[model samples]
Target: MSTLLATGFSAVAADSSSPQELIAKGEYLAIAADCGACHTSPKGGAAMSGGYGIQSPLGTIFASNITPSKVAGIGNYTEQDFARAVRQGINKQGQYLYPAMPYTSYSRITDSDIQALYAYFMHGVAAVDVKAPQTHLPFPFNIRSSMALWNTLFSNNKPFIAEESVSPQVNRGNYLVNALAHCDTCHTPRNALMGQDDSKALSGGSLGSWYAPNITPDKTSGIGSWSGEDLARYLKTGHLAGKAQAAGPMAEAVEHSLQHLSSADIEAMVAYLKQIPAVNTGGSQSRDSYGAASSTEQQMRGDQASAEPGWAVFSGSCANCHQANGEGTSYYPSLFHNSATGADNPTNLVSAILNGVHRNVNGQQVDMPVFGPDANFSMQLTDRQIADVSNYVLTTFGNPKVSVTAAQVQQIREGGPKPLLAQLTTPAVMIGIAAVVLLAAILLGVWVSNRRKKNVARK
Candidate 1:
């Protein structure tokens, strides 16, 4: 069988002789799962105390505390409760958790791995007494019970079971990607129900202001050109010179999770990713295959004037890091042949420009200044300016086909395209609506019958 990576397993040796040993294994598993990325408050709070707010189409869903504190955290949670919450999206009190927890993918975790994770969280982590802010979505979404029906439709992936035809290594990689990493949560496009579209897994999805590009093996609009080494390295470090650089949530994933992964685990992920069906969501050519070094030395020299709106903004704000030719520095990255810059959506580019990039890889920090309105001091860019700069960058150093408008910039600034669940009429919603109607009709009929009886008695 054709494979993308040089195949081998580099094992992180595990010892399960004692409780401490299990806790150690669990700690490694937690890093692989990237629990910290969502649970850790970016604004400063106790670890796993969960004050972070994840913006979704439904609303800002704040992560809940998973610490060992009995007061507000999960200190009192039994192993069964933990398993239910992690795999079934149900809390100790039987309250349904939103899919934002990625329980769908987590459902694939093996029992042994779950035990290890449980041990680590229970005995390893420091308890934080504070609780995370509760997630209150809008309208029908706020109705957490609705998720029970949604779960019936979506969250059906069983625990990890290796396929007979595939190699154990590929299965191991599959376990990491689906069970622990939950790569599909970000990479796969969501259906009308806002659940991961199984048919189009890893064909790209939206992350509010930023868009997650395709990771399928397709030669066009995907990572088909990226070799096994390229992928493993990218996953480990979050940046591949002349290919792509991590920004936004991807950057955070790298900083918190992927970079910490063992090379063998990363290689396994690459191997599994290679075996998935290739999907071509868009483009005639690869995303990173677009563009070349741009020369705006004329603008720098101030010899001739061009009416391009983004030129001035680029020269002033971006040129310092990206350089006049968009070649970038060793510490930074090149604009041309980069994924975010070359993607057809232009969402990531505009978002990166607006929100900036911050990632720490191999102990080296990479920071890109945000250009959006709420940026530090007055360095913020207006919607119009952001649009202009985006257009300019796309035309010169990135995908020429993509462009953004001030209106679009404003929309992205507010939040990317809303999820389809609220707009579309799904079966679950119809049932809820029908139930309400039936209840209302029953109440009305009861009232009428009572009134008629009262009138007859009076007569």
Candidate 2:
């Protein structure tokens, strides 16, 4: 009986040791999960003491403080409460959290990971007194219960199950991209009800001001042109191939999360992104001409120009580079014919115009001047003018079925563009500028030398 009791006590000790090991493991997992990116305030505000504002189509939702603070954070939450929140999107009171918390993706996280996350937050992380602000939601959406129905339709509770047939690397890539990274949440286009169109996974979608471009392996519409090294470099440095750079939300993602990932993890993300099939939504085909002869002709034909305020704005400001026909230059793509203008979401186009676009050429650089107050090209166009131009482009060049509002344009202007703009410094541009200066100096030197020779000859 004494021996049996001693054995039972030893078993209890071993079981207790598991929690400490779990806590340590959970801390590392939490880093990989990047929980601090959204939950914590910027500039390293009390760690995990959430007070970040997450913008959504519905409204700006403030992240709740998740610190261990008894009064302000998740101090009151039990392990089950934490698990339900992570895996089931339920609060301690059985209320649903918004999908913005990304519990929909976290639902696929392993039970062990969930428990470890709980341990890290509950025991490992420091508590803070920071109070999170209430979300600014309009009307019926303020009610948390509405999320219950949204969850029923959109949320999944199943954890990730690796496939047996695929290579281990591909499986790992799939788990990170689909589950923890939640790439589909942003890249995948949504249906009318806001559920992800699984058929078009990672094809692309328009967030408020910026469009997350298609990331699938389509030869034309997606990243099929990108090599694995190019993808890895872009993920690391936010710029690749002089054609694209990570901006706005993507910039934030890079600064906070992706940059910290292991090289293997980054490669895995690239590999998984490459595997997603390309999908074409078949919205708009080309930039719109608006049936006007030319800018001069449009000016002469006042009736046609006056009918649409948007077209007038575009004619005035954008016609210089984009041309009167909306056919853009070699570097400057024609608005009517380009995929960017014809996307389902006009957010990217509006953001690009309002903020400006600069594409790299051969590791050299060009800059699209920003017309906003923040940049040098500060044009005094009113919010209405901006909206009118954006609407005109969307209707004419983009999908005719969807329409954008002046208010939406105003929001985008105020919200600002993403992928923090790099300073206009490119080697090619620098070299060209240097060459011009050198030529001018040489010409001046020759002229001075000739003048000195003439004076000597006259003397």
- Which candidate number maximizes lDDT? 1
Q: Write the per-residue lDDT of candidate 1 for residues 299-319, one digit (tens) a residue.
A: 545653655768888887888
Model 2 misplaced regions, further than 4 Å:
1-28, 282-346, 352-408, 414-459
Could you tell me the TM-score of candidate 1?
0.90
Model 2: lowest-lDDT 10 consecutive positions: 416-425
Q: Global lDDT for candidate 2? A: 0.68
- What lDDT score is found at residue 184 in candidate 2? 77
What's the TM-score of every candidate structure? 0.90, 0.65
Give the Å shift of residue 349 in candidate 2: 4.9
Whole-model Cα lDDT of every candidate shown, in order: 0.84, 0.68
Please write out the lDDT profile of model 2 over residues 211-235, one tens digit for every residue: 7878787755676767899788877
